[model samples]
Target: MGEEEQEDEMVTCKTNREKEEKEDDAIATEAAAAAPYCYPTLRFDIPPYRSYHFYQQFRNASNPNNFLKSVNWSPDGSCFLTSSEDNTLRKFNLPDCVDTTQEDTCSSSLEDPYVADLIVNEGESVYDYCWYPYMSASDPTTCVFASTTRDHPIHLWDAITGQLRGTYRAYDAMDEITAAFSTAFNPSGTKIFGGYNKSLRIFDIHRPGRDFEQYSTLQGNKEGQPGIISAIAFCPSHTGMFATGSYSQTTAIYSENNMELLYLLHGQEGGVTHVQFSKDGNFLYTGGRKDPYILCWDIRNTVSIVYKLYRSSELTNQRILFDIEPSGRHLGTGGQVCCIFC
Candidate 1:
């Protein structure tokens, strides 16, 4: 009960408080380590400068008019794949480091660090291509992409070596080869969904051959999406649902489990060319060939269009694709006018 006893009690309390603070700091560090990596938000107010650019490699002497058709980034963001008019798929790996603050400058093919690292030539023009949903550069086996080309079966190409890994063939009723207009890997990356004329085919990723389960998009009563399917996008939230855009100007949502038509979206001025689901998978955005507007629809309520995002498209038959950013707060798209809309 003296002054020394009281001072001893206060020292003990201080030590205990310091120990608890250290424990709290350790817990916070562990939690941060367990959290997934997040990409920094982009600033649009300031004009963005290009860190890398490439040209000359895409040129073809035999086909002087060859041009890039579409570019898709890998799921891991390690690289990107490009399809071109020359019936070739090229993979370009991103550099390990870049000086974003440096002034923008043009670089020739020889000087460009973003030159194509791998290229796979197809027999015909590519119709659609998509990276494996679970692709990771660290895993060699998972680094592959599926591409559909004219008059050719769906090819699973190795992203690292540019080799033909596998093929999924679909035969017509008369036992002839049938090519898919669009192809995409399911959320699990265990199956590939392919779109054909008034039909959809599901192929097992492991077993690559003519074997497939076909579903007629056009039902027996003729109450379904008609014409060739142009694009396929799966729900990002692993909801076992996907949206298909058709050349018939109809966008249809289907249940991945049974290929059941959930809803049909109509309003595209031309044939639908692209369909992407929001990161939350609650909304769907669709773009069409020669269509100036990208229609947004709420899957929860398909009765009315939620809104329309306009782009400079309407004149070209080429597919003008748009994508929702990872944060789902912004959407970016390229149009025929050579400008990107965000």
Candidate 2:
């Protein structure tokens, strides 16, 4: 073919490619517009009303004092899991017709507006529990959670059927079984990170057994984060980093790739009970046992305490928990007091 003919064909091909690219962009834009992200709006000026109550569900007839210890919502927001003093983990599914905006949407006369759909009785007291990061109600295989209890191996339970899916065991140097103090799934949901006495263990989710990679939080000369690890949290941005809170009143950040200690934070008045990353993963919030303030630290600088959030938990030894909202604007905390602070 002549040179002019070849040039014309090249121009025609370029035009078609541009047209296809424009169509692809239009499709993506339309898809985004159809289901745009929505953030929740919370009002702090008015007193929050109770949307649901569950006094009857948690009450134990025999014990008469069974109460909830901690509560966590599933990753998909479809349900919530609660650990109670009765050595049981209960899963409560949110009702489809319930509306929080209305005062009397559900049965107002009922003492318990919701009941646990499933319950798993642990052999001992539950230390920590976390849902799989990728868990969804639409996917049965991904609908699972991991829990660590006293004198028991880490158990992965099916949220739908309330069955034990698998167990991840850790053995002490004496060849005896050891239980983790806290457990959490990595951001990828491919591995489970367990907190122990001055050490951390990583277990492959696909292989549930005694096999794991252990790393000591203490270095030579015994100068590192010591005491039992109380909590673990991963960065939401997938930065290959995580934070661990210890009973030694210290919180440390470590690299997920090599498990190397990155930074150690001090100034907690009591043993650190919970550590959480902000929605953007640039800051970390930590709450301690008997500590009324939740300290927020700028992970980037780590020079001094950024700010402290006050909660009514100075007199109790319970682990007061706090979490950042999805919008990263407001923070809510639970304490020993009757009221929840936001």
Error at 137, model 1, angstroms: 0.8
- What are the runs in model 2 whose C-alpha is more than 4 Å off? 1-41, 47-50, 99-108, 338-342
Weakest 10 consecutive residues, lDDT, candidate 1? Answer: 105-114
The candidate that achieves the highest lDDT relative to the unseen native structure: 2
Question: Mind giving the per-residue lDDT tens digits that candidate 1 earns over 61-117?
Answer: 777788877889999999999888888888988878887766676542356555789
Steric clash pairs (candidate 2): none
lDDT of each: 0.88, 0.90
Per-residue alpha-carbon lDDT of candidate 2 for residues 51-110, written as tens digits (9 for 90 to 100): 566777788588789988888999999999999999999999988785557676344655
